[model samples]
Target: MAKNASKGASRIRVGVGGWTYEPWRNNFYPAGWPHARELEYAAGKLTAIEINGTYYSTQKPASFAKWRDDTPDDFVFSMKASRYSTNRRELATAGESIERFIGSGISELGKKLGPIVWQFMPTKRFEPEDFEAFLALLPHRVDGLALRHVVDVRHPSFKVPEFIALLRQYKTGVVYADTDEYPSFADITSDLVYARLMRSQADVDTGYGASSLDRWAQAAKTWAAGGEPADAPRVTSTPAPDTPRDVFIYFISGAKERAPAAALALLQRLL
Candidate 1:
């Protein structure tokens, strides 16, 4: 979650994975900017932000409230369920950890809370029963608020129709990572599209060149229209709906400082 941009009847957001990085001061942030205003500054540039602080540990209610109050009313935050829940040895037994994360002031974001990203470890392969059990533990609602979940299964072994089917069964999205290092699954299992743009190059001024950003913008449109892109990587041969769907896109990791530029470029192309 970062900033939410709307074009016509579509909901498409372009942003980076997280804020508060030092490299951004020289690139994305203004020189000599106050550290406390980083989120405020970044929110003005992008449509949304994926909150990385929650991934490392549970954040306080005050932090969540402050974040919501600082950004624009339309700005959103997609948060990763803590590492303690996803990076554990037993995937099926993380209910308490998941509960702790869900209970910890997430409702403070209110309507601005986007999807809850559950990023599995790369070493974790497809164990259908075990995985389903873990998915079952994810709450559909927290404090009467709806929760959207996106699963980031990194292992190549997860590239199967069954895996996509399972996510569809639970209405959980599968992350589409546009990088060679991670598994690329573009199936639209849920009502929303979650993409992690991890291939930004540091050599270029914009993390991704103009042509690449154009293609991504087009893909975002396809996803927004509830259709799949012809050129996108697929986990299943099936197609998604032909109705409008919400889309959340992130320029994450690689060439970290240049990610904001890539995201903004994509946003501009969408506009």
Candidate 2:
């Protein structure tokens, strides 16, 4: 069962990228489990889910409402913003695409909505002015609901301190991608902490080893409590203010089949 932190502590939510995976049927899901009820079952085990389909195509408002209703009241979903807004040569020209994606009825998720992740391609270099323009295009509210935005910048160009400063200026969070394949950095620029743990091993029963899960649990708690992990790699040495911040950690993109086990293991540790 999921456990809540002490009263007044910031929440640390652990989950996987998406709920529908064929491999999960043999392991994570019960035998003969129906496909339509996968989200309901997954939500009962994990605290959050990173909705990836929206990145590929727009979803109907009914779909969002269905997702919201299927999950537990406290469950949250972090959606990946459409690629049309991020995968481009000129970031400044993505305003219309951004508006369209937001206006596509994402607010139907209502209180269940978490952060909207704007992910860029690995080749997309960080151009400060253009990147700032793109960030400025992100609206703070849509349909009377507040929105939180985070960027997943994969290019090595984003490793510079200037990139962290830009994120801070816009109050946008930077996704701390925990992987050797991408540019990973831990810098607190917003009120929330987002991390995508992408190094799950298929050979391990829990994706990551028990010791690794323990360490990650500690890191997640530290982040939620408003202190940076001493072992976290960072782009800047400057410290973030000591204030409680909500934390979201998703087991993503490694051995996809083991993501649910990894998330469940992490949630057990958090509890």
Candidate 3:
């Protein structure tokens, strides 16, 4: 499971997109769980959480501190980069927005901060030079805390060797989306692995069936051990260095109501 790996050892964290969901009140949350304590409850069950609200709006420093304090010491939060930084026509010109978002109290998360996902629109195409310029804008550190960046490029144009090369050059990861709706690839480009699984089915009690969850658990272990899953699709034939790396897997999209159950189920398998 590697969930309690020693210092300097790789860890595998499984979680859902976010903690707040209306449907979760009836299914995942307790009968009288207060809404204000949802983050605390979710953090106890899940190892990590992807903060989706940051994608739509800016948050105050106090909010980040409160979130940090509400969770367990081992809990992590992967924030979605602002839409203004990734949804624009010219990504190269998003330096100001990127700076604004990063400087907007995210450092308050401190050691609990995980990857920052810069999710591009589905219609956004890959432009080599412009994309490189945008990647250059991502700072390696924020307030002395190391920052990890991952790109969630949905367009098929990103399925190329050049795109992978750029990511590898910047040491930024490409989100390994486990879904048919986007360009899914497993080329490892950084020291950490970030995955967003979106194929959850509503009819399934655990979002994904038992076999699928088992496979994902195995895949996560393989990634943490610095190995690629043989079944995963890749755009580049070149292999990444086989070195231990931290892995973050989040059950996102699809049957959103079942995401918490899916995360918990996966965590159980990891154990």
| Tens-digit per-residue lDDT, 149-251, candidate 2 | 9999999989999999989999999999999999897999999999999999989989999999999999988988889999899999999999999999999
Query: Model 1, 121-223: lDDT tens per residue?
Result: 8998998998999999999998889999999988889998999999989999888998999889888898999999898898999999888888888888888
Off by over 4 Å in 2: 1-9
lDDT of 3 by residue, 81-110 (tens): 999999999999999999999999999998
Against the true structure, candidate 2 reaches a TM-score of 0.98
Candidate 1: regions farther than 4 A off: 1-4
Q: List the residue pairs that clash in candidate 2.
A: none
Per-candidate TM-score against the hidden true structure: 0.96, 0.98, 0.97
lDDT of 1: 0.89
User: In candidate 2, where is summed lDDT lowest over 10 consecutive residues?
Assistant: 1-10
**lDDT at residue 41 of model 1 (Cα atoms):** 93
Evaluation by lDDT, superior candidate among 1 and 3: 3
